[model samples]
Target: MAARRPARAAAANGEVRTGGSGRSDRRAELLRIAAGLFATRGYKQTTVRDIADEAGILSGSLYHHFSSKEEMLDEILRDFLGRLLERFTAIEEQGRDPKQVLDQLIEHSFATIHETPEAVALYQNESGALSGQPGFAYVDQLGRKIEEIWIRALTAGQKSGVFRDDVDAGMTYRFIRDTVWCAVRWYRPRGRFRHEAVAEQYLRVLYGGLVTE
Candidate 1:
């Protein structure tokens, strides 16, 4: 079973709407279809009909669940970013050594990619353009929030002498963020290496500086 969001959040978001037959399930299924389409086709290019076709429903039926394509897009991005921020916040709050926190953050990222690959890609590809657009201001905010979590861990590590002081923490965080998140382009969950193994190797190179001891 998939994880459940806080009841209040779900209710407020229209995620769990009126008592019904299979309406809720169908709504989620449609959102998943829309997310995959938007992620692959670029949000600007996908149409409601495309999602409806994929979901085997009429375009008219899709509007019953979501008000518009942008609304579907909004909910998808919000759902993905909200969950991601929550996880990162929890990891930071755990108050482990900065390096440890960073490790968990990376692991959480890889796991998210494995589980929500489309959402990850959609945010990366579309969020830059969506920042100032109506209803998507949160996109940039969430992006910054995620980055802040990383910079905090990296800077804290540098301060404690756990990470190299020579490198700028912000730059280092960007480097790692680009490297790890960009891997979704080539990462195959069931291929060559698993996420945990990839993360371990990435950690080795990232922390150990890719130099043989």
Candidate 2:
């Protein structure tokens, strides 16, 4: 997933809402702050008060926006995964070829990391612990859907000879998935290489052999 872009200005009322109207802008800000905290501090270690303090609001004020820290987590993950799956599905449906689809997928994955590093990191850190937890089933369900899209691209490429046939598509997809998403740990918005440059260089190595021809 990508890092979230910067939050916009909040409403004058100083309240954030998770399920209501008129405060979406402030609500997004609170989610951003909470995602940062959850990514840096373990979810188990983070408190609603911590999120409230970061937002410069009282804990009670935070509750007006979210019923609990868990709700915030759920909302963040659902939004992140939902957007990602929607984009990936569209890429697969509309791409000209398997190679094009795969390239867009890789590029988009990097872009996601750049845009929503906090959410990406939060998912990476907490997904395992969240497995089978009540009210978190969608975490794994959406993950499988996302995985299927990648694997389908890989399979299509191999069948069309755009990718090597000897390699297992499942294994190749796993390698690519891990290599791309794990970049969240070191990728910086102001780093030496921007996400586009990183994706370009990765695609170069991925499609071309490391050895001189």
Clashes of each: 0, 8
| Model 1 stretches astray by more than 4 angstroms | 1-15
Best by lDDT: 2
Q: List CA RMSD, all candidates.
A: 3.5, 5.3
Residue 122 local lDDT, model 1: 86
Which ranges in model 2 have alpha carbons more than 4 Å from their true place? 1-22
Q: In model 2, what lDDT does residue 154 have? A: 89
> How far does residue 57 in candidate 2 sit from its true spot (Å)?
0.8
- Candidate 1, residues 1-213, lDDT tens digits: the string is 113444433553443566674776777777788888988998989988899889888989876677778778877888898899988999999966998899999998998888888888888898888879975677787788889999999989999999889989888888899999988888888899888888888888876776687
